[model samples]
Target: MALDTAKKSQIIAKFARKSGDTGSTEVQIALLTARISELTEHLKINKKDFSSRLGLLKLVGQRKRLLRYLKATKYDTYAKVVSELGLRDK
Candidate 1:
């Protein structure tokens, strides 16, 4: 599934402007969350798709790294992103 281009661009723009800007954390998390959700739905439809599964794992790893970075650099931003994206308890 394709991402919402406008929204994805907005996140990339924000991150580009300021790497440490916490304002974009929610957007980043939201985009990743959406991707994860989409991949999950696809997996349900094609249970034998190993390539997609690998991609999903890679995305999850990337998201986890971003989350860890946010947590280490700015705990508040990490918490806010986590809450907004409902990514906890996973």
Candidate 2:
């Protein structure tokens, strides 16, 4: 259950720094978050899907690394993204 182009573009557009800015760290993290959520829901219904579970873990790790990079290199942007995405407890 991969993300379709429309959904991918929506997430990219929301986080993109500029027009057509698909490769930015914010956009990538948002995309991964979306995918991870989708996979998490799938796992809830299909608990035996080990492959998808592994994929979810990989996505989580990647998003964690990206968030760390953003925090180290651009703390303001990291904070902004985290707030906008509603990630992390208050």
Measured by TM-score, the strongest candidate is 2
In model 2, the worst 10-residue window by lDDT is 81-90
Residue 89 miss distance in model 1 (angstroms): 5.6
TM-score of 1: 0.74
Displacement of the residue 58 alpha carbon in candidate 1, Å: 0.2
Q: Which residue runs does candidate 1 get wrong by more than 4 Å?
A: 6-26
The window of 10 residues in a row where model 1 has the poorest summed lDDT is: 14-23
Q: Pairing residues by index, what is the TM-score of model 2?
A: 0.94
Q: Provide the lDDT at 87 for model 1.
A: 77
Task: State residue 40's C-alpha deviation in candidate 1, in Å.
Answer: 0.5
- lDDT of each structure? 0.75, 0.92
User: RMSD in Å for candidate 1, one decimal?
Assistant: 4.0
Measured over all alpha carbons after superposition, the RMSD of each candidate to the real structure, in angstroms, is 4.0, 1.4
lDDT by residue (3-43, candidate 1, tens digit) is: 78786676565444365553565556667777888999999
Tens-digit per-residue lDDT, 6-62, candidate 2: 999999989999998999999999999889889999999999999999989999889
